[model samples]
Target: MTPERREEPGRRKALAFTVLVHAGLIAALFLGVQWKRSQPDVVEVELWSSRPTPAMQPAPPPPPPEPEVKPEPKPEPKVEPPPPATPEIAIKEDKKKPEPKKPEPKPEPKPEPKKPEPKPEPKKPEPKPEAKTQPAPDFSEMLKRESSERTARTNAASAQQLANAARAESELRAAADKKGMQDYAAKIRGKVRGNIVLPQSIQGNPEAVFEVIQLPSGEVLSVTLKRSSGNPGLDAAIERAILKSSPLPKPDNPALYQRTLEIRYRPFEE
Candidate 1:
């Protein structure tokens, strides 16, 4: 079947479903609007009376009008009569007659004069004991001396500490150099020993020592047979092996490099 014919049934189904949904929505809206229109309006009322209520009656007719008050009249003050006036009496002074005057007696003679009193002797003041005074101490000079001594002690302690630290550092450096030299020698010996080929004539375990001279780059300049293993073939084999290891292994620390090295090797010894 063609594509358009296949889609026609689905399209018709969708259209029918949409129509049903719209009709349902419309019916619901219509019912809601009708219900609102049919509902009756509610009324609110407040009950009241035209005349005053018992709780609101006029206030007891103003408490029956207070009684009127009247003031009483005061009595009049009484009057008193004055006492009768006393009569005036006059007093008279008496006059005396003059008598003859009498004469005063003559003055008596004065007594002899008294001798003058002697003046008291003057007193001598006592001398007070003297107090001995001590001289004041020189505090500034004492303080300066103490401060100088303290500073000297501090300087000496600092110097001692510095010397101790320097000595310890030197010892540590020497130990490290020694270890580096040993490691460098060991590596060279191992390389040379690996290249040695033993002869069948070799009877017992033999040891050979070779003195090698090298440059800073580890290039061998010369190899001298310092000691032999007693066997001629073994000695020759050890020399050839030393020559084969021309350029030796270098030290890890450059400061440990040496121009001459004494390497000892054994064929069967570990």
Candidate 2:
């Protein structure tokens, strides 16, 4: 059949469905209006009283009248009929056209045969030179030389170790002797310093140097002034203090004893 004739049936079905929907809407609106009008009106009231006082007796003569209310009629709900069933129209589909046939692929050419590779020539081996025969070494002579060399090295190392030990011993002894002498001199100075009486005329700080001779028993033999303090009175005081300090402290080590000693003194030695 023609396409125009096929479309005519679909159009008629659409028109019928639209008319039925309009009729349903109108019926719903009319029912809603009627229900609102039939509903009863409500009234609310509130009562208030003053503060309570003492109870008073009175004559019972009046009664409260009853309130008169009119009865309201209930609205009857309208029943809605079920909507008509929609008609399902049969849709006619057009036939599909046949697809064109694809062209066949051509066969690939066969690969050429591979040629055989030529082989390399084998190399000739060269003649080896004859080895010369050597005489065997004398193991006894070699061992004798090695033993002598080891003995010489051991002797040299021993001598060096002994020399180093001797040198270290001497250095330690010298240091101890020096320390003993310094402590002895300090003790002597302490004694002399305590006996010294400063002269009133001695103004600035002055340094004096004195050379003292002592016996091994620590007895002062004599005292000679090497550098003066530039003041005669101060010099006399220092000399008297030194003389009073006779029999000074002796050295702890006898090797640290000296016949003559150079003593330096400052008036204000902090």
Judged by TM-score, which candidate is best?
Answer: 2
| Minimal lDDT window, size 10, model 1 | 86-95
Clashing pairs in 1: none
What is the C-alpha lDDT profile of model 1 across 69-167, one tens digit per residue? Answer: 001101100111110000000000000000000001001101101111111111011011111212333464445445555655564555455555555
Off by over 4 Å in 2: 1-144
For residue 151, model 2's alpha carbon misses the true position, in angstroms, by: 2.2
lDDT tens digits by residue: candidate 2, 124-241: 1101111121243446445544665565556555655555555565556545544565566567767776667767786676666566788888788998865576788877787787
Every candidate's lDDT: 0.47, 0.46
TM-score of each: 0.44, 0.45
For model 2 the local lDDT of residue 44 reads 10
